[model samples]
Target: MKEYKYTINGTKYEVAVGDIEENIVTVTVNGEEYKVEMEKEAEPEKKKPVLGKPAAAAASTSDEPATNKAAVNKNNAVKAPLPGVITDIKVAVGDEVQVGDTIVVLEAMKMANNLQAEKAGKVTAVCVKIGESVMEDDALVVIE
Candidate 1:
C-alpha cells in the first residue's frame, strides 16, 4: 500500500491507496472507504529567475513620499471583525452607502453574519469576492 497526504482548505488527511482498475481508484482515509477517479497531473509552473538587483529596495527609496501618502489614504479602510467566508457582497464600487448599510454577509461557524457599514461614504473598493475566506481584521472594503 502506498500512502499519500491530501490537503483541502488547510486541513490535511492521510490516505492509503488500495486498488486501481480502469479509471476508478479505491482508497482508505482514516478508516473510511473512498472511491476516486484518476486524473492527469497538471504541468509544473515555470519560474522566472531574477538576475539583477531586487526591485523592492530601489522602488522604496524612489517613492517614499508617494508610499506615505498612500498609507495615509488607507486609514479609512473597513476591515472584517472575524474570520469567515464572505458569502455575499451587497454594494459595488462608486455606490453611495449610508451608515448601517449591509456591506457584506460573512458566514462563520455555520451562521450568516451581516457586516454593516460604520460610516456614510462611497464604496471605493470591495476587497473580497463571494466564497473568499478572510481572517480577523482583514480589509474587506475601502470606503471614501
Candidate 2:
C-alpha cells in the first residue's frame, strides 16, 4: 500500500492507496474507504540499469599476438568499449599513464575512436596492436 495526500480546489484529502483488482483501486480518506474505478487501466512503472561504455581499439590478430601480451595481467584492466579494429596503440608495457590519456585508437563503425584511460596507472601490458580486431570488453591494456 502507498500513502499520498492530494488537494482539489480548496479541499485537502489524505489518501492511502491499496491493492487493485483490475481497473479499480481501494483508497481510504480519513476514516472512510472507497473503491475507485479507473477510466483507463493503470500500468506499472519499469526501470532498467544504464552503463557507460568507452571507445574501442582496432587491430588484427595477425598484427599483435593477443596470447603473448595478455598471458598475465594486473588486477585493473582497461577494456575495449566496442568491437573494432585496433588502428593504433598509444602506450606500451611499463609506461606510466594518467586518466584521459589515449591508450589506443580503435576503428569502429568506420570511425576512429581514441580509447582513453579512466584512472592514472602504469601500463602493465599491451593486449592488441594495429590491424588487430577486438570485441567489446576485450582487454586492451592492463593498468596497475
Alpha-carbon TM-score of each model against the true structure: 0.50, 0.52
Query: Candidate 2 — worst ten consecutive residues by lDDT sum?
Result: 49-58
Candidate 1 lDDT over residue span 1-144, tens digit each: 899998989988899998988778999997799999998567799844322225323534655434443554455767888899777778877899999999988888878899888999998766666666789987777788
lDDT of 2 by residue, 29-117 (tens): 97589999988845787733211112232234244555656475635778888999777778988999999999988889978899899
Residue 104 in candidate 1 has what lDDT?
A: 85
RMSD of each: 14.7, 11.4
lDDT of 1 at 3: 94
Clash counts for all predictions = 0, 14
TM-score of 1: 0.50
> What is the C-alpha local distance difference test score of each model?
0.75, 0.77
Q: Candidate 2 has what TM-score?
A: 0.52
